[model samples]
Target: MYKVKVFVTLRESVIDPQGTVAKDSLHKLNYGEVSDVRIGKYIELTLEKTDRNIDEIVKEMCEKLLVNLNVEDYRFEIEEVVAQ
Candidate 1:
């Protein structure tokens, strides 16, 4: 079996309004040292072994559905797992 961990985040050039709001809120709550905040998505997927290239499969999934190519960037890690 294989386990995939996907991370999705806004591109550096893209503004993150949600992250900004969170940072502002933190500053208001006495976190003056907080310089920045970034919000992102983490996804986990479990799949059985397949003949297809795992990297290609993951890239396709991220491009087709998980990430916005225009404003977001993504990365993934694949790990082999032993089914219980």
Candidate 2:
């Protein structure tokens, strides 16, 4: 078995309105130095079958579905499960 962790984040120069909202909230709560905030999603997947070669497969999935190549960037990792 293998574990895959996926992370998706907006590229720099892209305005994140939601993040801006969070920053505003922070400032309201006394976080005056808040410069910016960004949000992203983290997904964890348990693959039924995988080995050392899992890296390539996970990379392909990220490229094809997990992230948008034009506006968003994504990264993922695959790690073999060790016996407990």
Candidate 3:
């Protein structure tokens, strides 16, 4: 088995409205030093051993479903599961 950790975030050129809203709210709550905030998604997936390369599998998943490539960027880390 393997564990996959995926992170998805808006592209640098894209505007993050949710992040902006959160930042504004923080300032209202006395967090004035918090100038900026960016929001992203973290995903965890477990997969059974497969013949395909883990890297390829993860990339495909991210590109096809986990991210909107036009506006978001994604990264993933994969590790083999060790049974106790």
Candidate No. with top TM-score: 3
* TM-scores, one per candidate: 0.95, 0.84, 0.95
Weakest 10 consecutive residues of candidate 1 by summed lDDT: 39-48
What lDDT tens digits, residue by residue, belong to model 3 across residues 1-84?
A: 999999999999999999999999999999999988999999999999989999998999899988999999989888999989
Pairing residues by index, what is the TM-score of model 1?
0.95
Candidate order, TM-score descending: 3, 1, 2
C-alpha local distance difference test of each model? 0.94, 0.84, 0.94
RMSD of 3: 0.8
Predicted candidate 2 versus true structure: per-residue lDDT over 1-84, tens digit per residue: 788889899998788889999999999999999888998889898987835467777787788887888878888777779769
Q: Model 1: per-residue lDDT, tens digit, 1-84?
A: 899999999999989999999999999999999999989999998878999999999999999998989999999999999877
Q: Flag clash pairs in model 3.
A: none
Name the candidate, 1 or 2, with the larger TM-score value.
1
- Candidate No. with top lDDT: 3
